[model samples]
Target: MNLEARKIEFVQEFLKLQNEEAVSRLEKILRKEKNASNERIFEPMTQEELNKRIDKSESDFRNNRFKSSSELLAKYE
Candidate 1:
């Protein structure tokens, strides 16, 4: 069946549900599916953008511009 017809049928079946736990479980599943779809909307960086980031990182390393693991740990402590 088409999407709208399927949705109407689902609603009809859902209305007939007598179990509260089953409805709650279906609600949780719907929420998880929605959150997953939202997460999939994020765009990744292009290869050129990635290369530029790598180049900047190398320049920072050459200039001794980054922190050390010990320095970072000391600051947190």
Candidate 2:
């Protein structure tokens, strides 16, 4: 790559190590830009939707949609 690109990449990696908050903010900005580029993309889920999903996940676990680790290992063996 070009010298400028290499410099920018190094700065980004260094910032990721030295300033995690900056790195996280940069990632958030990039994700928003990517989502904005796609008009048909769905909006972010609301708090209510997230709570419902969490409840459903808990229910699924209680109903054993996920098998035990020992059972998984036994099946593999």
Candidate 3:
């Protein structure tokens, strides 16, 4: 079956579940899978990349090219 269909089927089965332990296991599995997926997406930057970012930040500060935290917060509010 396709992914969407499979997800619907899974949800239907999950909704009928009567066991707390089974639901807890599913929640733990989902959290673990999500964390692993995030780790893969956000791999640590290299030393060279870190240095480049630091230099850019320093330049922006000297040039007054950045905004304050209050200014940023005000923008969304």
Pick the TM-score winner: 3
Question: How displaced is residue 25 in candidate 3, in Å?
Answer: 0.5
| Candidate 2 structure quality by residue, lDDT tens digits, 10-53 | 77786658667877887798799888889667699999999999
lDDT of 3 by residue, 1-77 (tens): 99999999999999999999999999999999999999889778899999999999999999999999999999999
After superposing candidate 3 on the true structure, give the runs of residues whose Cα lies further than 4 Å from its correct spot: 43-49, 52-77
Q: For model 2, what is the error of residue 63's alpha carbon versus the real structure, in angstroms, after optimal superposition? A: 0.7
Candidate 2, which segments miss by more than 4 Å at Cα? 1-36, 39-42, 67-77
What TM-score should be assigned to candidate 1? 0.54
> Which run of 10 residues does model 1 get worst, by summed lDDT?
6-15
Candidate 1, residues 25-64: lDDT per residue as tens digits? 9999999999999999989999999999999999999999
After the best TM-score superposition of candidate 2, give how far the Cα of residue 37 lies from its true spot, in angstroms.
Answer: 2.7
Clash pairs for candidate 2: none
TM-score of each: 0.54, 0.35, 0.59
Which stretches of candidate 1 lie above 4 Å from their native place? 44-77
